[model samples]
Target: MSDNYTKIVQQNLHKLYTKLPPDLERNLPGHRNGQEFMFNAFGEKCTITPRAITLGDANYPAIHGILISLYALNATPEICLLSPFKSFREFPDSMPYVGAFTTHTEQLLEPHVPDIRKSAALITRYFNGEDVPVQGGGDFAFTLFPLPKIALCYIFYEADEDFPASVKCLFSNNANRFLPIDGLADVGEYTSKKIVDLICDVNSPS
Candidate 1:
């Protein structure tokens, strides 16, 4: 499986490099250092060149590698549209992944709302996030970019006497313009996991 993913990522990289976008820096919204493009991915430093994509000096996972390459290949000059965040169900052809998206992205964070709230500020900083006004009313909410072109708005509702803790994740209006539906779903999953990891880091004995 890993080998297959490697081939896929390599192929995508080749396609992206063949005719690199002239305005890659603006499209990717990342820094271009010579032939290398540097950006923050899932809160980690990601450097992509014609040959490979690395996150903090290590090879990025195949799935994520593909998403990054795709993001670059589809790079567009339009600014990221963050207002009017939309749910996964709002995207066309998103029905197939809606259940999994909810399970992996939202419900996955339900158990840690408190811990996540504790580290919300740190998570925002780690992901170059911006605090957004809570929409629809919630305990708190914030927007963060896991990729240069994609922004996710996360809203949290703490457990109350009648309802259990819950989480909601919404995407920037133009998120689909950057990656395909499946890729966007994976982004949600991975970003959610990264949040859980951050909470774990906070709890780990220092």
Candidate 2:
């Protein structure tokens, strides 16, 4: 499966390079020097060229590589509009993936709310994000960019006398302009996974 995924990523990179856009920098909202582009992806530095997509200093899993490439391929010149964020289910034709998106992206973080609240500052700094005012009076909330052109806002509600802990993930209003719908779902899942990993690392014995 890993081998197959690698091949798929390579093919996607080929496609991205073949029809490379002249305004890629503007569209991706990333920096370009010669042929290489640099940007933040899921809280890590990402470098992309015609040959490969690398995160930080290593080659990441194929899923990440594929999503990064797709983000570039679908890059648009329009700036990201984050106001009035929308939920995954709110998007057109997003019903099929909504359940998985909820489970993997939102619910995945529910159990770690207390840890997240404690480390929210660290998480925001790592992801180059900032705290945002909660819209509906939740326990806490913050917004982070999982990709250069896409921002995700995570809202949390602590368990209380009558209800259990819950989380909600919302996308920047125009997130779809930078990736296809399914790709957007994957972005949320991967970003959520990154958050969990960061929390685990912080809690691990040193």
Highest lDDT: which candidate? 1
Model 1, 137-181: lDDT tens digits are 899999999997799999999999999999999999999998999
TM-score of 1: 0.96
lDDT of 2 by residue, 56-171 (tens): 86556568988988888888878899989999988888999999999999999999999999999988988888899996778999999888779999999999999999999999
Measured on C-alpha atoms, candidate 2 has an lDDT of 0.89
Pairs clashing in candidate 1? none
Q: Total backbone clashes of model 1?
A: 0
Candidate 1: C-alpha RMSD after superposition: 1.3
